[model samples]
Target: MWSYVGKKSNPRWLWHAIDHRSGKVLAYVFGRRKDEVFLQLKELLEPFGISRFYTDGWGAYERHLEALKHEVGKQNMQKIESKHINLRTRIKRLVRKTICFSKTIQMHDIVIGLFINRYEFEVSI
Candidate 1:
């Protein structure tokens, strides 16, 4: 899981992405939803070829997940939706902000990358 304090005024949104089959988080990026977020996501997945992508209604996925088949809409991507629920429950710091994040984007990348690694080896349900 990854997150960063945003714009000084917005609540921190922790972003996380996991493999549906293995339950390993592939990548996470934080900061106000922007092009850079998608860029980070792309960088994370570039090493591993992605056959398909499942995302929520968030428009960012639409703009970024152009190379692969993307399944949007709630009904189309229930697995990812359910995985997010687990992510929120397990990563309380991400959801509740008990820990204040560094204002810098670099810090966000480091922390988020660490969290993703922490869960990377786990098997999916």
Candidate 2:
């Protein structure tokens, strides 16, 4: 999903990877919705040894993930989609602070990363 820093035209995307079986967020990265950004998220997921990937036919996924390992369409993306809703609703409701209303990229990533690390992964960092 995308959010703007100061203006709508400058969108920063939150790329996520969800565990298919558990429906838990494995990792996420905040940056432009470009291949390099997606690559960063993919790199973070390397240790999981993910066998297959499901995406909404995003070009970056197709370009990086092999055809056999990658599946297009929203066939098994419901969990991830649900997570999106939760992030939007819960954050907006719970953190009506500078985090959600961030005007800078550094603050945006730091706050959201902290929240995700603490709540999503059950760890404090």
Candidate 3:
């Protein structure tokens, strides 16, 4: 998902993966919506031994994930999408309005990361 630091024109994407069955975020990386960013998230997920990836038809996923492992369609992505909605609602910075915004990339990532870690993963930080 995309949010911005300082302004709407400067977009920073939150590239993340979720456990398909549990609908919980597994790993995430923050950067521009580029293949390198997605690759970083993929690297973070390597230890989990993920056998399948259900995702939107993003070009980065198409280029990186193998056909046998990746399934591209919204139908298979409902859980992740719902998680995104929950995030946008709970975190003001992620909402698609100017009411609240982060001023720095570091803060943007840190806040969102903390929220996910605390809320979804139940990690004590």
Candidate 4:
């Protein structure tokens, strides 16, 4: 999910990814959808030793995880897509898309990342 900040002269992109089962953020990258962003996401998830990954047909993800020998498949990707819906529904700032919210991509990504981490903990308890 993404939105533009009409009021801000500069716009940023925010990206977050979570483990659907745990509802925990495995990685979050704040930047343009470039090779560097892909690398950062991989770096963040390396500690988890993720052997399998499911994602939409995103070229960046293909470049990043494929090289790491992570199995990427299209089938059952709905689980991850569902996570996106869950995140958006819980984050009012994301739902509102107000002018003041998510002025920068990095900020939005970090916020969402933190929220996922917090939300997962809350859900378990």
RMSD of each: 4.8, 3.0, 1.0, 4.1
**Whose TM-score is greatest here?**
3
Candidate 1 has an lDDT of: 0.62
lDDT of 4 at 122: 50
Residue 25 displacement in candidate 2 (angstroms): 1.3
Candidate 2 — which residues are off by over 4 angstroms?
93-100
> Which 10 successive residues of model 4 have the least lDDT summed?
3-12
lDDT of 3 by residue, 1-125 (tens): 98999999999999888888888788988999999989899999999999998888879999999999998888887887888899998998999876799999999999999998999889998
- Show where candidate 1 strays beyond 4 Å: 1-8, 96-115, 122-125
TM-score of 2: 0.89
TM-score of each: 0.62, 0.89, 0.95, 0.65
Best by lDDT: 3
Off by over 4 Å in 4: 7-13, 20-23, 67-74, 96-100, 104-110, 121-125
Location of the lowest summed lDDT over 10 successive residues in candidate 1: 1-10
Model 4 lDDT tens row, 18-120: 6756756666666665778667777888898777676666787776666555445656566666766786677655654543476655666667667765765
Candidate 2 per-residue lDDT over residues 19-41, each given as its tens digit: 99998789999999899998999
